[model samples]
Target: MRYFALATDYDGTLAADGRVTKDTLTALKQLRASGRKLILVTGRELDDLLQVFEQIDLFDYVVAENGALLYCPASRQEKLLGEPAPTEFIKALRDRQVNPLSVGRVIVATWHPQETAVLETIRDLGLELQVIFNKGAVMVLPSGINKAAGLAAALDEMKLSPHNVVGVGDAENDHAFLSVCECSVAVANALPMLKERVDFVTDSSRGDGVIELIDKLIASDLSELDEQLQRHNILLGTKKDNSEVNIQPSGSSILLAGTSGGGKSTLATAVLERIAEQKYQFCIIDPEGDYENFEGAVVLGDAERSPRLTEVLDLLEKPYENVVVNLLGIAVEDRPAFFAELLPALLELRSRTGRPHWIVVDEAHHLMPASWNPASLTLPQQLEGMMLITVHPDRVAAAGLSLINTIVTVGNSPQENIKAFCEALGDCPPQIAPQTLETGEALAWFRGKQTEPFCFRIAPGHRERRRHARKYAEGELGEDKSFYFQGSQGKLNLRAQNLILFIQIAEGVDDETWLYHLQRGDYSRWFRQAIKDESLAEEAEEIEQNNRTSAHESRDAIKGAIAQHYTLPA
Candidate 1:
C-alpha cells in the first residue's frame, strides 16, 4: 500500500488537554483492525505520556523525548535512541536556577522563557546539542536527532518504508517527520506554517481531526489523495526549453514505445530505478525475463517454473517489497489469460490497501494484443500506476491504449509512433515532427497537456539493467557477427559464438592467449558488437587500458565484467 502506516504526533494532534478522546481511541482501534500500523511520534517524555494517556498500549510504537527514546507498548520496552542529557549540563541548569526543568532519559526540557538559560548553558559547556521549540515548550536533544530519524528507526525495525507512511502533526517539531512521509496531514488547529506545508489539513481540530483522517483512510484507503502523489513525481527528463518533465504516480499510465534495440528498455529501467529509490512498490511482469536482476526487487519464478498467482499476490501484500514476475516458463499464448486472472486480484488489492503502487508490463503487445477481446479481461476503465513497454503499439489492444495518458517514444520515428498509437485509438494525432534522438533520449507527449512534444534525455539508472542472459548463452551468432582472436602463428578464429562457450574458452586459455585478446581490445569489441551491450563494452575497454597487471588478473577482470552483465548457465 502507498500508505500502510500512520505516524502521528500526540499533543495538539491525537490528544486534547493531554488526553485522547473515546471517539479517537475507537478510530485507532478500527484503523488497526484494518491491518494498518499506528505509531505515536511526540515530544513528550515516555513517563509523562504514560501518566496522561492510559491508552498508551493502543499504539504499536512511540517515539518519545522528541525523538531520543523509542517505546514499544506491547513489550513495554524503552530503547534510548540518543545519548542522555549530561549530568554536568543538568547541574549547570539547576545552578542557574532554570525553573520548571524537566528531564527524561535523553531529553531536557523547559518552557519558552527558560530557552535563553538553556542556550547559555549549552554555549558555556560547549555541548553538541540543539533546542527545538513546540509552542511554549523547549526541548533539548542530541545533534542529528529528530522526529524524522526516530520514525525512520521505527520503520526500519518494522520493515516499512517511509514512502508507505502517512504522518500527521500540529507543531514545529512535526515538520521533520511529516516531510518524510508519503502524505503529510495537519490538524485544523495546527500551527499556520505547519498547516500550509502539509498535503491535507483536517476540518476538525485536535483528536477529532485525527478521527476524521482515520475514517477517510478506512473508507477509500485515501484514494482522494491521488493528487498528493504529485509531491513524489518522477522526473522523465528535461524538455528542449530546459524545463523539467515529470509524471505523477497516481491515476496515470505510461507507454514506453519504440522498435527493438532503440533504448526502450533502457528508458524504462531508468524510470524503474527512480521508482525503487522513492520506495514505491512495483510489480514487473517480465515477458522476456529482462528485469529479474534489477536492484531492490524480488525475482519470482524462473525458466523452469512459472510464478503462481497466489504467490505473487502474497509477496505483494507487503507494501515495502517489489516483485518481478518472470514469465519465461509460461507459454506465449497463455499469458493473456493469466494476466486476465491476475489483474482483477491486483485491482482488488489496490482498492483495499492502495498497494503495489505500479504494475509494469514489459512487451505489452504480447499480453494484450489487438486481436484479443478486451471484454474478456477484467481491465480498469481508468488505469492508474500502469506502465506498458512495447515495440509495436498497434498490436496492443485499443482499450489498453485508451488508458495511457503519457507516451514516451524512444526511436527515430517517435512522431510516427505517436501517430500510430493515436490512430489505433481512432483519435487525431497531435501535430509534431519526428526528431532524431540519440540513445537514452526520447520524445514525450502528455495526452492532455497543451505543450507540444519535447525531446528529453533519459536519466541514467542507478542499477545496471538486466541483460537477456539466456539469449546470450543459447542464441545464434552468425559468422559475420562473430568476434575473432589473433594469435602468434596465425589469426585464431575463436568465434564469440555464445556467452557460455566464450567464457569456458577464456578460462581454459593460457596467459599468452588471454593477454593477446586483452591487449587487442577483443573483449570490449565482442561485448559491444556480439553481446550488444555498450555499457559493459565500455567497462571492458576501461579494464583493458588500465590493467598493468598479470595476464591472469586481466582475464579475471574481463570474466567478472561479462558475468556481471550476463548470467552463465550452470
Candidate 2:
C-alpha cells in the first residue's frame, strides 16, 4: 500500500460543534478495518477532548495540546511529550489579567486579542517557549515542541514513517504536522493560506471532508497521489545552471551508468545516503561487495558464505532496518536465477506494506544480462523505488532497461554512455553537449520528465567508501607475472606472488634491492600491469621519482601504498 496511515486533525477537520457525526465515525471505523492506522492531532487538551467527544477510541493515537502529549486510546495511557507549563509563566499570565486562560500538561492557551500579553509574559519570564495561533485561539508550547514533534513520537511508537502517512488539517497550527507528512491535505473550509500550502483540498467541509478523504484512501490507497508527488520530490543535486534536480520517490526507476573507475559508485552512495537519512528502508544488492560500509545498513553474507533470503526478508520487515545482500559467494552465472526468486517475495512484501522503500542493485548487468528474458522474472508493471547501477547499460536485460525512467551517467564519456543506454532501449538519444564532469559529478536525464540532460555535482556520501582489498592481497598470481626481487650479492630469483608476499619481501630486502627496483620504474610497471590500477601506479611512480628520498624511505613508501590499497587476510 502506498499510504499506511491517515493523520487527521480534530476541531475544524473531523469534528463539528465539538462533536463527530455518526457518518464520520462509521467512515473512521471502515478506514481502520482497511488495515490503516488513524492518528488524531489536535490543539485541545486531553481532558477537554475526552469530555467533548465520547468516540475518542476510534483513533489509535492522539497527539493533544498541540504536540504536548501523546495518548493511546486502547491502553488509555498518556505520555507527556514536553515539559510542564512553568508555574512562574502561568502566574505571570494570570497577573496580566489574561482572562479565560486554560492550562494542560504542557500547554497554556487562550483566545485571540491576548497573544500580545502572552508574548510579553513569556519574554518577561525568559522562558524558551513559542506561541501558536489557530483561528481565534493562541497556544504556548516548549520551543521545539509542536504538532510535528508529537506526530513523530506517535509514528515512532507505531513503527511507521512519515513518508507512508497522509496528514489532513484545516487551520494554521495544523501546518507543522501536515508539512512533515508525505501528502498534505486540507478541508474545503480551511483558511486560504492553509489550503494553498497543502497538496489537496477536500470538496467537502469538516467531518464530511474527512469522510471523503477516508473513502478515497480505502478505495485506491491514494493511488491518484502518484501525480502529485512532485511536491514531495527529493532534490538529487543542483544543475550547471544552478537549477535543482529532483526525482519522485514513487513509481520511478533510476539507472546509474558509467565505466569502471568512474564515479558511478560514488554517485550511488550519495543518493543512498540521502535515502537512509530520510528514514526510508532500502535493500542493496551488492554483486562486488561495494556497499557493505554504508552506515545504518546491515551487511549480510561475505566472501565465504551466501546470504539467506529468509534473513534478508526478515530484516527488511522492520521499517527502519536496511540490508546489504552481498553476492560474493554466489556464482556469477546463477545471480539472475537467485534474483528471480527474490524479486517476487520483495514485491509481495511491498504490496502488503510500503516497506523496503528502495531496492538498489549494484552491478545490475550481472543479474539482468542482455540474454535474459523479461518474462523470466517477476516485475511490477510500475517499477517504484528501484535503482540499477551498471558499467554497461546495454548489457542489462531489455526488461530491466524498459522500466528505467531516469538515467545518471558519470565518467569522461558521459554522452557516449547515455547514447549507449538510449540505443539499448531502441530510442533516439537526445542531443546533449559533451561536458567534462569532475570526480563527483554526472549528467542526469529524466526520460519521464522529458527535459534536456543537465550536469549535477553529486553530493558526498555519509559513509566512507569501502575499497576492495581481497583482490590485491590474496588473489593468486602466476610466477612469471609476480614481482621479482634481486639482492646486492646476486639475483635471488625470488618472486612475490601476491601483495602480501610483496610487502613482506620489500620489507626484508636490503636497501640496494629496493633502490634498484625504484630506479628502474619496476614498481610502477608491476602495479599498472598486474593490478590494473592507474591511480595506485601513479602514486608509486611519484615515490620513485622523488630524488630527495632515500632507498629505505622509498621502500617504506612503496610498502605503505600496498598496505593501504590491500587488506591482509586474518
Candidate 3:
C-alpha cells in the first residue's frame, strides 16, 4: 500500500491518437478495484477530453489544460486551477496571425511554429507567462502552473501525499508532474531525455506501456523495484565496511533500545531530522514531553493539558505537518489506554494516505507493556513501518516486540539489551561481543538476516540540542562541571550551579570579577564542555573576543544567548 494512487498522462501515454484502448480501460478498471485512486494529467482542454473520451468516469480526478484546470468525473465539476488566458495576450497573438490558435479556460495552445510568434507577443506585451512544449504542441499558461501544480492540488484535496503516488507519462511536458511523484515511469515511446530521468521505462510503447505499469503496480505495489529507488531511503550510517546503511522507507520496524541518559534521544533526534528532510511526516508519541520545542515538529500537548485525538487528526490532514503527541498531562496509569485508542486511529489514517509515514512511540514499554493484553489493544500483525524507542524492549507487549526485526542498541551494554529482547521473544540471541558504545555509536542487528551485530557511527542531528537542558537549567551539576565565579586574585568563591544561578551571579558580580571570567573564556568553556551546548558556546566565544564592551554589556549578551536557547525562571 505504499502507492495509494496512480497519476498518468493522457494523449501520448494513456491514449494513442487521442483515444484509449479497451484493454487499457480494463486495466484502469482493475486498478481502481484495488482501492487505488486514478488521476489523469493531460495537455488537452476539458471539453476536448470529455468529447473524445467517454470513459472519463473511470478517473477520480482529471488535470486538464496542461495543469491549468481540474475536472472531477464523478461530480462533473470543473475547477480552474489557473487564471483564464489573458485577453490582452490572446489579442496580441491574433494580431501576429499565429494561426490555428486554441484557447481553454487558462491555457492558449498552438503548434510548434507558432511558438516563435507567441514568444514575441508575450515579450512585447510584457506578460508573465511560460511556454510549455508537448511534442509539437506549444501551450502558454501562468508561470508556475503546470501538471505538477494541478496534480498537487488534486492530492491536497484528496488528503494524499505525493510520496504515495506513482506517476507515468511521455514527452517533455510530462517531466514536471512525474518528478513530483514517489515513483516516475516513462513509457517506451516517451522522449529519450524523459526516459533517461525516470525510475523505469516500460518495454511496451503507448497504452500498452501504461498497462504494463499498472500490472506491475497491482502485482506487487512494485516491491521488486524497491532496491532501485534508493533516493528515498533514510540514511542511518555506514557499516564497518564503510558502506552506507539506511532504513527503507517502508517495511522497517525499528526498536531503538538503551538505558536512561545513554544518548538515545540524540540518535532519535538525528533520525527524526532525516525523516522530516525527506518530506515524510512523522508523529512522535512522547509520554514524558521531552520533545517540546523540537525543530520541524508541532507539539500538541503540554504538562497542563492532554492533547485531544481529534486535534491530532485534524492537524495531520494537512500532510506536510509533523506532530508530537505529548502524554505528560495524562496520568501514567491511563497512558496505555490512551495509546490503545490512538494507535488504531493513526493506522487507519495511514491506510488511506500512506502517512504520517512514521509513527514514533517514545517510552514504548509504558504504552504497550508486557502485562497488557495486546488482543484488547487490537494490535495488527503488520504495519508498513514505525519506530519504537524504549529502555526496556522486553517490558513491551509481545506483539509489539515481535514486530521489531531490526534492533538498534545504544547504551553501556549493547549485548545485554539484545539478549533481553531475544529472550523475551523466545529466540536465541545473536552472538554480539561485549562492547561499550561511545557517543553517536550503536550496535545494529537485523534478526535472521545478519550473522552478528555490527557497530556503526550514528549520524548527527541537524539541530544541536542542549542535552539534558532542563537538568542543566534547574538541577545541580557536579562540582567540577558547575561554573564558579572565582574571579581575578581568587577573591570570590561564588558558585553558579545552574544556568539560572550563572546568569544571576553574572549580573551581580563585581565588574572586575565579571571581566576576569570573560577575558579568561571560562563562560564559553563551561558552556561547551559542561552544558554540551555548542551553539551557546559559539555565541559566548564571539562576545568574549570583543572585550571593548563594558562588563554589563557582555553579561547581558551572554545572558541573552542562554535565554534564547533555554527556558529559564521568571
Candidate 4:
C-alpha cells in the first residue's frame, strides 16, 4: 500500500531540544511537496510547541499534549480530546504545596513528591484521569491520553488509517503511534528501546534520518505497485488488497455466458480492453464482425478477404487489438478445421509473445467445439490468458470451461450453466442468480473458496464500448454494412487523423509538437506517431467521440447509400 501519511514525534524525534534543524525542516517540507500528509505527535503544550516550531503550518496536523489534544497547523485551530481538570482537584493540589502548571488543553503537570494530594484527589473523584511520567515531568490528563491516543484522534479527524501511515520517533511517548503504523521507523540516535521495537532503524540521525526513510520509500516503487494493485482489486482481485481473488487453478477458460442481446459482446469487449490496457496483446475471434472497431485492434477476416493463419499469427506477435478472425460467412463444417489450424498458431504466438493478456473467442460454440481438446491448443502456462464468449455456456467444451480465472455471467438463465461449470470443476460456489442484470451488470465469480461472488456494475467509463454495441445493434448507427464503407470514402478520415493526433498526445508528444508534423504534411509519420502514443486519456476520449459521431453518421449514410444504389427489379 502507498504510505499516504507520516506520524512523527516532535521533541527528541524530529527536533532536538524542541527546535527542528534546518535540514529536518527541509526534509519535512520535501515530504509535503511529495503530497504526503505530515502529522506531528508531541508532548509539548500546543502553544509551546507552536512557539518552538514557529513555522507550524509545515505540518498538516498536530497531536499535542501527548495524546490529549489535536491541532490543525494550517487553521491554527486546536481541539481538546478530554475535559479540563476539575477546579477542586486543582485547589487540592495547591493546598498540598504542589505547584500545578497548566500545560496544553486538558493537561496539567506537576513535580512528583508535592503532587501526592492532586493524585489522591483525582482518585477520590472516581475519575479516569492518570498522571504519566515523561523524564522529570509528571503529566496528567484523562486516562489513556498518550501520544498514540493523540495521534489516533488526529488521524480520525483526517480520515487516515494507521495502516496507510509510517511513524518515526525516538522517545517513549512516541511508542503508541509507532506501534500502530504499518511501518514504524526510528532514527539512529533514537533510544535503543524504541529502535528495537520499530520496523526499520535508519542509519542517519535526526533530519537526515527522516530523509533517508523517505528516499527509501520512494525508491521501493510502492506508489506504482499500489496503483496496479488497485486495478487488480477492481478487475480480478478482491476489493481490498488484503482480500485476495481466488482464481480456481483448474479453470482453463472463462466463458462469458449470457443470452443473445444481453450485452454479452460488450462484456467480452470490456475484458479484452482491460487486457489491452495492461499491454497484453489479444486475438479476438469475431464471427459476427463485432470487435473489429476496437482501437489498436486488427480485423483478420471480412467479406473481402480472410487473413491466413500465418498472417494472423504475425499480427498477434506484434501487440494489436480486435485481431478478429471473422468466421461468419464460412461454412459451419469449415470452422473447426480453420480453428484447429488457427489454435496451434495462436498457441505458438502466445509462446512467442510471452502470451497476450488474453485470447478471446466470441461465438464460442460455433468456432471452438466442445469436443476439441483444449490441450492441443494450450500454450505454455507462462503465456495463457483465455476467454470464451458464448450464449450457451453448456455448449462449450466442459474441459475448456474449467479453466476460468474469472467468470462473468450476464443474463438470468445462467444458473444452470454456472452450476454445470462448478460441477465440472468440482466444489464450485453455487451460482447466484442475478435478479436483473440490466445491460452493464454482471456476476463475477472469483477463484477462491472464502470469497463470495460480487454483482457489480462495470463502471460507466469502462462501458462506452459496450454502449456502442447496443447502438450498433439498434440501427441508431448505420447497419453493419455501413461501417465497412463509413471509412471507405475517407469521410471518417478526420477521425483517423484525430485518432493519430490523439495517439501522439498519448505517446508524450504535446499537441504543438504533433501539429508541427501535421503542418509538414507528414501523414504517414503522423499515423505512425499516433499508433505508438501511450496516453490512454486523450486516445479514449477521442476514440469515444469519434466512434459516437462518425460511426453514427457513417452508419446512416452507408445504409441510405446502399438502399439508393441497390434497388431490385421491380
TM-score for each predicted model, relative to the true structure = 0.67, 0.70, 0.81, 0.41
Best by lDDT: 3
Task: Supply every candidate's count of residue pairs whose N, Cα or C atoms clash at under 3 angstroms.
Answer: 1, 0, 0, 17
Which residue runs of candidate 4 sit more than 4 Å off their true CA positions?
Answer: 111-118, 221-570
RMSD of 1: 9.1
Candidates sorted by lDDT, descending order? 3, 2, 1, 4
Model 2 whole-model lDDT (C-alpha atoms): 0.86
lDDT of 4 by residue, 1-570 (tens): 246678888766787766778877877777777767889887788878766788788888888887888889788788888888777777766666677566456888876564566668787877678877665667888877788788878766765556457889887667777877756889998888888787778888876788787776656623423332232222433333334333221123566777887767665665565555654456777777776577768777775666588777666554333377777666667776777678777775443333444677788777765666653354343223677888876666655665665677767655565675676556545646536666666666655435566665653335564343333333232222221112223342222223322232323433343333333334333323432222432332343344334433433332333234223223
**What does the lDDT read for residue 162 in candidate 4?**
60
Which candidate would rank higher by lDDT, 1 or 4?
1
lDDT per residue for candidate 3 within 1-570, as digits (tens), equals 899999999988999999999999999999999999999999999999989999999999999998999899999898998888779898888888998999999999999799999999888989899999988999999999999999998998788999999999998898999999989999999999999999999999989999999999999999987878877898778877888778787778899999988878888888898989988999999999989878889999888999999999989988899999999999999999999999999988988788889999999999989898853357787765789999998898888888887888897898899999999889988777788988778888887684578889887676634446778898899999999898789978999889999988888889999999899999999999999889999999999999688888998899999999998879
- Residue-by-residue lDDT tens digits, candidate 2, 335-425: 7888887777888877766878899888888888888785345676577899999989989887788888999998888998789888988
The local lDDT score (0 to 100) that residue 552 gets in candidate 1 is: 76
lDDT of each structure? 0.85, 0.86, 0.90, 0.62
- Which lDDT value does model 1 have at 97? 96
Worst 10 residues of 3 by lDDT: 459-468
